[model samples]
Target: MHLHYLGHLPPDDPLDGYLRFDIAPQLGVHRTPSGFRVFQFDFCRDVYLYEELGGAFRVVGKFFPPGRRMAPGLVRPPTETEFQNLTYLHRLGLNNGSFRITRPLGYNPWLHCVLVVDHFDGQPLGEVIHQAIRQDRRNRLFRKLSALAEFLAVLHNRTAGDWTVDFSHPYDYNGRLIESLVEKRGMARSEAEEFYHLRENWRARTCMWEDRRVLVHGDATPSNFKVGPGREVMVFDLERMAWADRVFDLGRLAGELKHFFLQETGDPWAAEPFIGHFLWEYCGYFPDRRDAFRSITRRIPYYLGITLLRIARNAWVDWNYRRRLLEEAKQNLRAIP
Candidate 1:
């Protein structure tokens, strides 16, 4: 097979509408990429829900990036290399130790595997950010994060796997991940420094532990959880759930707090209080990993930079991809403490 350039599409250009011609294996269903508000349910799992598909039927789809396929829509949802990382909560019967994540709700003008998840209503972490912004209160954020850490602690106790059995943190160490990014990603020198520090701070290798483990949601982020009625907090995506370091799960959440939620309102300080609550709420029981929390929190800026680079690098395929990424890099550095 010869390598052919799909060419670059600018960030503003519609990623779903790119031209796919003959001489290539066609990807999944065809559809416009924009419009729906998307968020995550697990590692490499996401859902874009349309409240009303323009008066037709409500539409939603679970996206899998690493495996490269959409749940029930076009064979491939557009944008195979989506910008952000997919976090917790997977569709029913995936890897979460169950066969029923959702019930086939019914049909829509769009696709199949229509899931009618019973009691499938909950506010994702992203939505909570809006609420946090509204009331000028960090309580909800702290509460939610607290629930998440507690949940992880229990999951850690319940899940039992052996690193001697199985392991799955794609990047096991700081140096390994950094070298790959620098080589394959061609990362800038400055960005490399941040990535290096973030990786080291987390003691990245600890995230690779597979043994002496308990069932974990592997990737715990706001987007992966929902606050249901009655203050019921339910987790959705479990694609990356594993019996591993508690820090891995919380680290993911802490890192996200800096990037999407806190930064959006330009209130980095908003993360200040929650950090303590998160660690205090979680580490009380899992005393083994308390230092890990402190490390993760302190390294959030570096992690944010790493995340921005991931976004910037992919966007580089499009015009100004490099320039835009460089700008983000500069901005990211300035945000550092």
Candidate 2:
């Protein structure tokens, strides 16, 4: 994480007086060897912690990126509304339900930056999934999935709205997926046209989906979630949260589940059972499970294709695998009915 070093611990601190006083007890007497004063946040955000004169650790400060580096040289800065939206989303997460999340303590909008939140401690779901699995671990995983589904249901129910796509859309969220397929993934013109045609067909087919527009955890990769002792799930990285089709999240998760299992066993088939179980658990939240299950089944393939295409654009994926992802996306689009 590239952090903008505002100041040192004691004197050079640019923090507001109230924040400084709040964290004064937790400020260490000295800095680390590398002059590093903060803990691991994320690539685009800066997270600062205060380990008290005693030993307790608490997150006191966070600086969100004015601009994010998308490609090697491309930097995208968020608008004022976009930045404020993130803080509001975090507040919503902190206030809602049995789901665990970083508690929003405060916000500093002077530079249109800085959000303060309480640090949360838990095992990253990605690491837990990557580890060796036993029967006990499997059962625990199922429990966590159930909790996650319930949590998402709560979030969706709380924030459902008719947010206009072109007006309120902060991220250019869905359009970027199309951009990735063509520009980033290097799909042939004809292939890209066919992909767009298929996407439009699928969209036209399900455009009448009755599910209310709700806040979706736009990025649902395993790394964004953590599981605690009681199998409680905590999610972070809310910059992608948006009011859209909830299926966007469900499909992204399913795509990630498939991707992870495929990477682990080198067999696409290994993901099928887990994917089915996850979808089943998620559908259990709706009163009409059969209708919900059928609706999700119809819609998921489209978003899953979007997820697969997005993954294909990643630089780390080798040529052959990228081709596979593109192929899978096509298969998904073709299967949509």
Compared with the true structure, what per-residue lDDT tens digits does model 1 show for residues 1-337?
Answer: 0122233334353322221121011222244332322233333333544322222233334433354445442343332211111212232123233112322222222322222222245566678866777766567777777666666655565454554323334234334545655776676677777655645444444433333645556456666677644335665544444445445565556656654544456555565566567767776665557775554444344434444444444522443444444454345434433
lDDT of each: 0.46, 0.64
Which portions of model 2 miss their true places by more than 4 Å? 1-10, 16-19, 22-36, 41-50, 65-97, 132-136, 162-175, 207-209
lDDT of 2 by residue, 58-164 (tens): 56455655454434422333333334555676666544445766555556556336666555677777666666242335656667777777777777767878652
**TM-scores for every candidate against the unseen true structure:** 0.51, 0.78
**Once model 1 is optimally superposed onto the true structure by TM-score, how far is the C-alpha of residue 319 displaced, in angstroms?**
13
Clashes of each: 26, 1
TM-score of 2: 0.78
